[model samples]
Target chain A: MSGQTLYDKIWQSHLVSGDDEAALIYIDRHIIHEVTSAQAFEGIELAGRSIWRSDSILATPDHQVPTTEREKGKAGFVDKLALLQVTTLDDNCDKNNIVQFKLNDQRQGIVHVVGPEQGASLPGMTIVCGDSHSSTHGAFAALAQGIGTSEVEHVLASQCLQQQKCKNLRVLVNGCLPLGITAKDLILYIIGKLGTAGGTGYAIEYAGEAIENLSMEGRLTVCNMTIEAGARSGLIAYDQVTENYLHGRPYAPKGAMWDSAIQYWRTLVSDADAVFDKELIIDAKDILPQVTWGTKPDQVVAVTSQVPEISSAKDAVQQADWQKALSYMSLNSGTAISSLSLDQVFIGSCTNGRIEDIREVAKVVKGKKVASTIKRAMVVPGSGLVKQQAEAEGLDKIIMAAGLEWRFAGCSMCNAMNPDSLASGERCASTSNRNFEGRQGQGGRTHLVSPAMAAAAAIAGHFVDIRQVELAQLEGIH
Target chain B: MAAFVAHQGWVAPMDRSNVDTDAMMPKQYLKCIFKSGYGDWAFDDWRYLDAGDVDVDVSTRRKNPDFELNKTIYQGASILLSRENFGCGSSREHAVWGIRDMGFKVVIATSFADIFYNNCFNNGILALTLKPEQIERLFELSGDKAMSLTVNLQEKRVTLANGEFYSFELEENRRFKMLNGLDNVATTLLKKQAIQDFEKQHKQTHPYYFTPLR
Candidate 1:
């Protein structure tokens, strides 16, 4: 028998029965958000079926809730449809007796952030969410996959998903991480090497010394973008970092149970002789802080590099993609990336909206003023708790002092389903995932960056090498 | 769910790779809470000249003349022949909903993102891939003109109007679901005993999963 990878071990433990053709897998957690969920709830209601394992479900609204005026709950919405969707989730969760962090609840936040914070997603378990970023919890060595709304309903009705096995693809990012480089840059670099579909039909395990050295929050940020590589899911083995993060989280096991859980989690690492279907080793030294200059996440360039020229593309087909991106983003080919002026700066999303990300932003712009060329910049925390912690540490004050709007929690401008959206043709430096066309709002160009990069962009009004800025600030203080 | 035994329709070539769900049904239209109304918003950003939201009626939006879907030749096309990573970002079934609502029963791509591919069969749409050369050939055949293709799920072949055909492989489980219109929910319900058995054993083995919140 071959030694199983972390994913295989979790899969075996969750296998209800059957083969890879149609294996019945027991679902340990289901995280639900509003936009993808309303139809699922409707399916459950129309079918006249109740939740099979309601205890396994965690419900929250992220996509459509207004990040501002959230204290008023459904009444906070200036958009009636948005209000209806947010309240509908509340009614469904209440009616089903499922635990939900309601809009006004302090515990509420992005489903991905809340999952790990509350420890609802634990090691050696199978986690599914309707939103794609659910891979964030895989930082805990869980087999986490993002599901569509239909699968959401199926999980609600059965607590079991009929799944086929995914092949394993291990990505080893070794070597020391350069200063001022973040997990966002690391993952973006990996995605650049592996095109949007490079990890298709496989589950990716992120390993190597660099991955093993990341903080739980940093690891979560990396895993959250797994789907962008078209991977089924992403996983990282449980280690002391995982234990420290989950130790006393609300839903984590307690007392003797904690010891028991740790024993099992200690087994989550891949055995020495274990083999993967495919493997790619990335040296972290080759990575630089990334800024996506195009419509796709894979069309990324280093902050100091020029916007990629169409001729630089590998083939005519690639040039075609580059042409579309260049046209849509209204950028001239071969222009310096740092020369592009920004219309706005947004620092939030499941990927970069964590508390540590807020701290990074505070460090970058703690006393700096927003550049006169920048029209607007804002910071929306991941969860109400994140917002509260930033306020406690006075990070929010520093960010607000730098002239960025400090907003409440929700997906906010990430998807811009609510009132927080970019105007037509507005360019932005954003800490959110996905640089897809019209992702923030129609015709709103977005350059994906790290929190510090976005904060620096807010002050500089253009992309700059974050390392140089940090070094300058350090020297000035000295 | 409807059985997808065979589908024949005008093939509309999307002509781009990495077309995401967000672009298919932009976030503005995602709050509608129902699946049926997303057709007009399938490629909302590109299909229209004016921006749309759930508040503004799509009927009032000006159609972009340059867009493929708005072009007269591809009207009522039900098969989408496109390129690599056809559905890449987000787990929004609304993308599949928008495509289905737009009347596309089959999407031929070089590859598809996993979640979007799964969402397709669940909603009675067939998302399949062909060899690179085959996709290239299809694009060449259909360039700047509306072409018709017959997607036969039963035989796993896509037949062109010129009688050329490409055979693709699909997992038997997914193929069974699409051909029979058996939604996994109804099918999984039949395995209630197995789920219960698994739960019983799972609780005994992994006691932490069932413990009360502290």
Candidate 2:
């Protein structure tokens, strides 16, 4: 028999029944949010079907909810469309008997953040959600991926997804990460190297020294953007980091059950001789803080590099794509990225809105002031829980004192599900994934960067290489 | 669900690669939770010169003559032939909804991102993958005028207007689902007993996952 990779082992274990090509993978947990789950619940009701197991489904309202209701003096969503969607989600979850962490719920946060924090996502299980960043759960060794709305209904109605197994891929990163280089940069760099479609038809397992050394939250950030690379899912084997993160959480197994769970989790690693359809190796030291200069996530360059000239494009297609992106972004080819000006700075998203991400930003901007040229800079934590934790640690105070708006949690400006959006022709230094045109708003331009880079950009009023930032001089001065 | 056994329609060639879901249906449209009525909104930014808003009349919007879909040659086309990695970003199935609502039934690409591919099948739209060279040939065929092609699911072939044929392969399950118009919700429900049994055993082994209802 062929040796099994971590993905193969978990997939096989979750198989309820099917052939080699297609299987009904038993979903251990289903996480849903307001934006994607409404139609799904509506679908079930239209079809006269009840939720198969509401007990396993956890609902929350993230997208389209006002992130700072207390600050804005608004009780709930003021936009009619946003109000309708959130209310619909609440009604649907209630009708289905599914537990929901609503906007007012103390546990309310981004779906990806809340799942791991509540211990609902665990090692050796399969998790599915409606948002593309669902792969974030794979950091715990779970076989997690984002499903389409119909598949959402499928999971809701039957708790199973009819899935064709993806081929295995291994991305091996060796060596230690350089100082100030983050998981976000590493992933953006990976996407930059592989292009957006590099991992098509494959489930990638990130391995080696760098992968093993990343914190659980860091690993989540790495896996969160697997979709940005066009991979179905990303995985990492469960190790002590995974165990420690899961331990003592609200839903984590207890006592002897925890011991047994750990025993099972230990088996989640790929066998020594396991093979992969594709393998990519990168030296961690070679990676630098990355930022997407163009529309697609893969249209990226290191912070130190100049925007690529159209003439340097390998083919006519790439040249044309570059030209279009540069025109849309109002960026001149061959210009240094560090010299570009930013109209706003946004440090939030499922990608970098976690507590750790906030801490990184707070650390960098502890005593700095937002630049006069920067119109607005804000921090939207991933969840209410993350906000509370950041407040507890005084990360919020540091960020607020640095002249950045510290708002409540949600996917604010990540995809413009709420009013925290960029105006037409506005350019932003963003910490979210996906630099696609109009992602933040209509005709809005985005430069995807790490949290520290975003913070530095806020202070500089333009993109700045974090490595060169004079933090000491900026501190306590306007 | 509607069956997609065979279809014959005018083909519009979109030469660009990595046509992500965000471009297909921008995040601005995600605010409207209801699924249908997104056809006019598909490729919203690229489709028009002025910004398109929800429920805005398409007639009033200034059409972008440069966009592939807005070109007179490709008007009324019901099939989209594109290059590699079509629909690459965001798991928003609304991308498929917009494509379908725009009246296209089949998307031919050299490759597709996984979620977008699955979303197409679930919505009764056929997402056909062709070899790169074959896709190149199709692009060449649709270069001048709008080309018409016949896609047959059972025969597993795409026949060009000139009678040139290209064979494709689909996994049996996906093929079955498309031919019969069955979605995952329907097929999965058939295995309710198995899922129930698995859930029962899963809960017993790991009861920690379930949240107590307040």
Candidate 3:
């Protein structure tokens, strides 16, 4: 018999029924958020259906939550439509009897962050959310993937999701990362190596030395952008890093159950001779503190590099793509990525709003003020807990004192869904994913970077190599 | 929820790569409670000169004559043609809903994002993938004009107006579902007994999964 890959092993364990053409995969945890779940709830209500297991779901309002003026509560939401979607979520969860962390709840944050933090995203489980970043939970060896609103309704009506088999692809990152290079830089570099569509029709398992060396926060960041590479899901085998992170979370298994959980997680690794349909290997040492130069995530280069010339495109399609992106971003060919000035610098989102990410930001800008040329700079923590923890460590004070607003948490400034967003024609050095045209706002341009890079950009008013930031400022990042 | 047989529509060539769902349905329009009104707002930032808002009237917005869909020749074009990785980015079904609401029953691209491709079938929209050369050829065939194509799911081919058809692959189950317009949830519910049985056994082997975390 052929050896099974990690995705295959986890997939077999979750199989409820059927085969490759279509299979009913049992979903153990369904993470729900406001923007996507509202319609799904409406669908179930219209169909006269109830959730298969309300306990299996965790609900929160993140995408549309106001990230500032928390004293006003929901009234803080300046957009009435945003307020409506958020309140509708509360009503749906209330009617369905599902547990939800409300706006005032400290547990509330992005679904991707809150799920793992609360321990709902456990190893060897199948977790689905309406948002694509559900892949973030795959860091714990869970079969996590995003579902659309239609599938979300199906999961609510029936805890099983019908799926076709996805081919297994392995991304092996070898060697050790440099001192300041992060999981964000590594993943961005990988996406650039493999074009945006490279992972289509495949489930990617990230393996090798560097992936194993990543902290759970870093692993989550890598998995969060799995969709950006066009893969529905990304996974890393369960390890001590995962177990340590899951330990003592409110939702994690306790006592003797922990033993059984670990024993099962141990078997989640790929067999030695497992064959993957495709494989891409990268040396971690080859990666630099990366930054995106174009609208597409794959249009990235090292922070020290210049915007790629159209003549350098590998194919006819890329040549055209390069030109289009250069036009949309208002950047000329051959401009140094570091010389690009920014109107705003945003540090937050599921990808980089964790406590570790916050600490990195603080370390970079501890006593420095945001550059005067920058219009605004802010740090939105991933969740209420992340904010609380940052405050406890006085990291928020360090950030705020650097002339950047240490704001409340949600999916703030990641996309234009919330009150926090880029103004028209503004160029921002952002830690959030997706620099797609107008993703931040209409005519808004975004440069995707790591927390440390975005922090340094906020201070310098331009993209700068984090490695070039003064030595004293880089103290704790390594 | 709608049945698909064959679709014949004018091709609206976007001629761009990596066209994301955020472009299909921008974040501001996602605030709509129902999915239907996204028609006018689909490609809101590109289709209109002004920034879109769910609260404001879409009619008041100035239409950008330069946008492919807004062009006089491609007006009401129901087949969206684009380059690789179309519908990449966030998993918003609003992307599919808005495209469908705008009357696009089919999309032909070099490739598509996983989530958006899946969402298309659930909404009775046909998402087709052709080889890069074939897509480039189609772009040349439909340059700056209204060119209609017939997308036959049954035949598993798309026939250009010149009677040349390009074959595409669709797995049997997905083809069957598209042809009959199957509501996947209804079909899955038929196996409730099987799911219940699985649950019973799952609890025995992995009781930790069933334990409530909160």
- Give i-RMS (Å) per prediction: 1.4, 1.8, 1.1
Which of 2 and 3 is ahead in DockQ? 3
lDDT by residue (tens digit), candidate 2, A81-101: 777788888898887788898
* Tens-digit per-residue lDDT, A194-288, candidate 1: 98899998899999989988999999999999988889689999899999999898999999999988998999998877789999899999999
Q: Which stretches of candidate 1 lie over 4 Å from their true place?
A: A471-478, B212-214
**C-alpha TM-score for every candidate:** 0.98, 0.96, 0.98
Every candidate's lDDT: 0.89, 0.87, 0.90
Candidate 2: lDDT over CA atoms?
0.87
Residues A1-478 of candidate 3: C-alpha lDDT, one tens digit per residue? 8899888987898788999778889999999988998888888888888889998989999998888888689879888888899899899888888889999899999999999999999888999999999999998888899989999999999998989889999999999999889999999999998789999889999999999999999999999999889898999999899989999989899999988889988888889999999999999888899999999899999998899889999888789888888999999988999899999999999999998899889888987889999999999999999999888888877888899998888988897688788888899999998999988888899999999999999999999889978633544334
User: Which ten-residue region of model 2 chain B has the weakest summed lDDT?
Assistant: B205-214
Q: How does chain A of every candidate compare to the true chain A by TM-score?
A: 0.97, 0.97, 0.98
Kindly provide the TM-score obtained by chain B of candidate 1 when compared with the true chain B.
0.96
Q: How are the candidates ranked when ordered by DockQ, highest leading?
A: 3, 1, 2
Enumerate the chain B TM-scores of all models. Answer: 0.96, 0.96, 0.97
Higher-lDDT candidate among 1 and 2?
1
How do the residues B61-153 of candidate 2 rate in per-residue lDDT, one tens digit apiece?
998888888888898999999987898888999899999999999999999989999999888899999998999898898987989999999
Clashing pairs in 2: A109-A383
Which parts of model 2 have CA positions greater than 4 angstroms off? A71-74, A470-478, B203-214
